[model samples]
Target: MNPAERLLEVGRYEEAERSVRESLAAYPSDAALLALLASILRARHDYPAALAAASAAVAANPRRSAGHVERAESLILLIRSREAVDAATTAVTLDPSWPGGHLVLARALVAARSLPAARDAARQGLSLAPRSVAVLLTVADVERAAGHREAALEAVQAALALDPGNAYGRWLLAMLDAERLRVRKSMRALREVARDRPAAPDIIAMTWPIRGVLSGLRRGLAVGAVAVCFLLAVGHWWWPQVDTFARYVSAVLAAVMIGFAARVLVPAGRLPWRCLRLLPRLMRSASVASLVLVIVAVGALIAFASSGWWVLAVVALGAVPVLWALGLVEMVGAGLDDPGMRPALLGLAGELREWWRTTKRELREAWTADGRRGE
Candidate 1:
């Protein structure tokens, strides 16, 4: 094996970097060496240097997909999603049969929040290489972001089946089940991941209660907020009949409630722009019956407040509990399908199976190589 390849395989990335650098100096126009350097830089998390190395490789050999894929990953790390997508697209266009390009494109599109497109690209990669752990994880992430939690869980389960020690896939399953409020599944997956990567950044930074498991408090809080909004609608409708001050309070409450709902639903901060674009579509992915219930509750509040339909207001508030129940039922139903424990157990089993097979294969190959050399 080449010095860089040997060092990289042994996880001595710094040594690999030095070896690649030395080789690149000797063969300045060697695109493969540049690609190796790009990979080394990426492994070291030196994204800017990785991007430069990858770009050099692409410039040296535009026909190769590896350089473009490396460039796309570096671009993604640099938060240049559009450029990453373009680079990845170029890679796949150059070699449609290569799963690498499709994988990169899928990931870049996911980062760009073009979820449907990301899912499509991921599916394309999977169609090309169904056993690819990378593509499976990408598809899982895409499905999760698209609110297809069951599908996402299934993808992670499949990936774990291929290579059981994939922390990223485990992390994904934990987070997905967590979001869907599957307490036992979330905790099981979360504990397994924490065992492997105790201080994983995402886990450390996670604000989710119970270490990424959805606590009762979180669900109750969301439910309470929605219920309060329905109550506000009632006030806005009936308070005018009571007094001037009461009516004024109702208006302020209604405005505040609206703002709160928007903030909670759309989410804000780092990806506010992208969230704004995706929120409507994501909202539509929610339980249809539950959504209708909430809508009817809100509409009834409006009717009572508008047409002085006091009776309708009572009916709307009465239905709030039922609507809330239905939403919870829908969420729980989704969670039941994504039982985290089963997937985690499968992953563990797969890891053991893979280890056993790999050890036996390596022993067999070594024995054969020795016999050949002796002969």
Candidate 2:
């Protein structure tokens, strides 16, 4: 069992499958083996085969809750939520004291968008296994989807308290904070989680949004600069009032960029040299260039507001095009405003990367062993 588990853990699916087949040849009707094989098939993403394996396990021993749980898991993987709920319910009835059954039920309910039922099922599971991070996360997901944001926050906080090193827990906490408009706290929490798991699973892939925040803002500023260029050109001679308002708005924009850049370049409680050293090198040169452009833009805006000379700001706008061409201060990434497919792809990619690493390690070990001479 340990060998099979290790094989599965390290993505040696073919060997794991072979091991299971050899074992089943000796114990053809073993329900546990059938259930284990179902799980192995699931890991290999052979969902239909996994379903068949799980069904065989259930048929082999109707009294065993493990078979039912395995069946439920396979059904959920196939997106057969209703069937999964039935299978999970059977597991719960067969073994009313176990958390596995309720966890499956909760997961199926979440897929079905039956938030109330999922929350209840998760709570039932938590009552049985009070410290299960998976069950707790499910509860929090249900609460969040049901518009109980604060409850979701509380649940995740409890999960973090239980396992502070859980990357998913920290990511979820950070997302909840982000949702509530606590940007600084969310940024800090997200950064901490990202630092811990550079290739985070799809379940907590905040890297794109978090890492691209400054870039996105800069991109936005570039676009705003273009728009302001147009507005200044049109409003300079035709609309005195328009030019006056554009000046104040441009000044505000310059102030905002300068302020945010300062925050990023210089955080409090550090010596000036250390803070400068810690600043992201990617943006350092761009930040200096942008500050200079901002100063020029501010000066132009004031001149335009005072004497209808808004055309001067247009020269400052040329810097944006240069930066954009250099690929320095530009918008990039799907960002936090994504329509929501990136996280799944990232998760899949992360799993595949791990599988590749495990396979490499196993091959290396086997090659070294083959080179050893027998004593």
Candidate 3:
């Protein structure tokens, strides 16, 4: 591999881009350098630029499988699934022996929602280069898309075992664990990845509490609101004569709890504020709504207890469903947006299917055995 290739391999995308660009200045028609530039651009998440570079590379040499692979990857990132599949198929047709081409085809097939074909293509690449980390990662990705969590996990683990410090592999594992609700494990892995990649988008920083504290508080608040509403109903039914002084005391405690929850859960400081900028616009809006609703519910609890306003309690009760819905949206949106979380989400879906299948099979077998006994 050239110096530019080595830099790209190590995730020094900017340096690799500079190197390749310098080489391209001297050999502007160099298909290899153009493809290399495309890879660097893709790594940096500049899909448009990457696609342009890949196109240039293909124009320079249509027969070069590497150019076609880069083009396919760029198209996939752009969400042009059909075009990506076509580009990848061309690469594979040009060089059927190249594991890289097969892996690209697998990824394109995945983008096109052709899971079985994607799996076959990935397996073919793995067969060609069993020890290749890239090939293994492709297989893992295909399995994850297929909702085969165990297979995806095993493949990724193998890739990591071969190259323990592989950042992408580590990130993928973290996401895989997270999809299964292993929050602590996922957070630990994410922290390690963050340490290595400080300048990466604020997505990871935003993800910290979104996955942990926010989720916990969301569940806690939902349950707490329900319980409080139930107790209020019981009190109204059994002891209709509640003293004002006791109501005031309950209101004070509720206020304290709200203050404590805010102090602990709300992100503060310039860093957090800066990280907040990385969230999608809709997500930012949802987050604000969630925080506001949390405070509103607590405030309603205070008003209801202190002033004997039953309607305030009803308002708090009404907020629960909306709060829960917002939390669910945030969780699923984060999972879909984050590369690490996306696979985990897919894996979780697969696990759910497996669980239902197992339950159904056991039920059927039990029913059959019961029928035989009756006979």
Candidate 4:
């Protein structure tokens, strides 16, 4: 095996960089060394340096797979997606069987939101290296982005089957279930994964808000119920002459209560719970109901405006929550179906959670050690 390949295998990236640099110094225009250095730089997220190294490698050997792949990756980091796509295409054309080339092409296609092509490239890479967890995950992501929820789930399941301890796969599955409005299942999945990997902050961050919202809504409902009962009792006793006004007030209060209830109930699927199977249908129903409410409000506003009932128009305007809920539900549904978009969205989320968990673990360890020293 080559020195560069050996260094990479052992995870000695800094040493590999120095070795490639020394080798390139002797040859002055060694394409392979330049490509290796570029790969190392890209791995380190030094996009500018990687781009320069990759450009040099391509200049020395335009036909080489590694050079093109490196250049394409750097271009992607630079957000020059169209150029990245062209470079990836060139790499694939020159080395159709190269796993790296296909991976780069797949990433570029995803960035461009060309879901079908991205899925194809990811699949091609996976076919060539069926055991590669990275390729499998990427394929799953592409499938999700393409609006194939079932396919994306299958890909994620396959990835988990291959590497059952993969935190990324488990986290992604949780997110998918949540989006589908399988609240209980989603929460359970998140809890299971998060417990095993307590270092993942993103899991807690995402889960906490949903949990809080659910709790808050429950509290609000209880408070509202009590308030309504008190108001009804007052009208029953001392406000008999004001019964007509009381009925109008009750109608308004009911509308407000219904709106609040829907807000709280509609988002219940986002929580982690045992009753998750009802999420998808609930999401669909909530979206439809919210939309209908918005439409009715719009018509009411228009009619009131025509009749100069500006006060009623202003009241109708308060129905914004229903519209927002409808939009959120629609978005959640759309995200669940597309496989190609899943990885970057879900993977990033998982990675962020992992990072947060790691940081917290380190901080806790440090704090404990400091306390021991103090004692």
Which is the leading candidate under TM-score? 3
What global local distance difference test value does model 1 have? 0.68
TM-score of each: 0.58, 0.53, 0.63, 0.54
What overall lDDT goes with each candidate model? Answer: 0.68, 0.69, 0.78, 0.67
Q: State the lDDT of candidate 1 residue by residue for 203-320, as single tens digits.
A: 3223333212122322433454345445555557765334333334333433444444443333312322222223223222334454455556545545544555446545555665
Which candidate should be chosen as best, given lDDT against the real structure? 3
Alpha carbon deviation, residue 147, candidate 2 (Å) = 2.5
Model 4 spans with C-alpha error above 4 angstroms: 1-19, 182-375
Q: What is residue 194's positional error in candidate 3, in angstroms?
A: 1.4
> Which segments of model 3 are wrong by more than 4 Å?
10-15, 205-282, 294-375
lDDT against true structure, model 3 = 0.78
Q: For candidate 4, write residues 1-375 as lDDT tens digits.
A: 669768876668788888887888798688888888888877666677888999999999998888999899887776567888999999999999877789889998988888889988998998898888777778877787787889888888988999988878887887777556565566667677767776433423244323343334334434433343344456568775443443344345445645654553455454433323234464445545654664455454444434534444444544554455555665566455433234436556888999999999999999999999999
TM-score of model 2 vs. true structure: 0.53
- Model 1: per-residue Cα lDDT at residue 238: 69
How many backbone clashes does every candidate have?
1, 1, 0, 23
The digit string of per-residue lDDT tens for model 3 on 1-375 reads 889999998888889999999999999999999999998998987777888999999999999999999999888877678899999999999999999999988998998999999999999999999999999988998999999999999999999999999878888887788667565666567668877778773364436544354555566656655666566666677755543443564476566665554553353323334555577665666676887887787788787776877677678778878977887787666545744344445556888999999999999999999999999
Clashes of 2: 1
Residue 273's C-alpha lDDT in candidate 2? 29
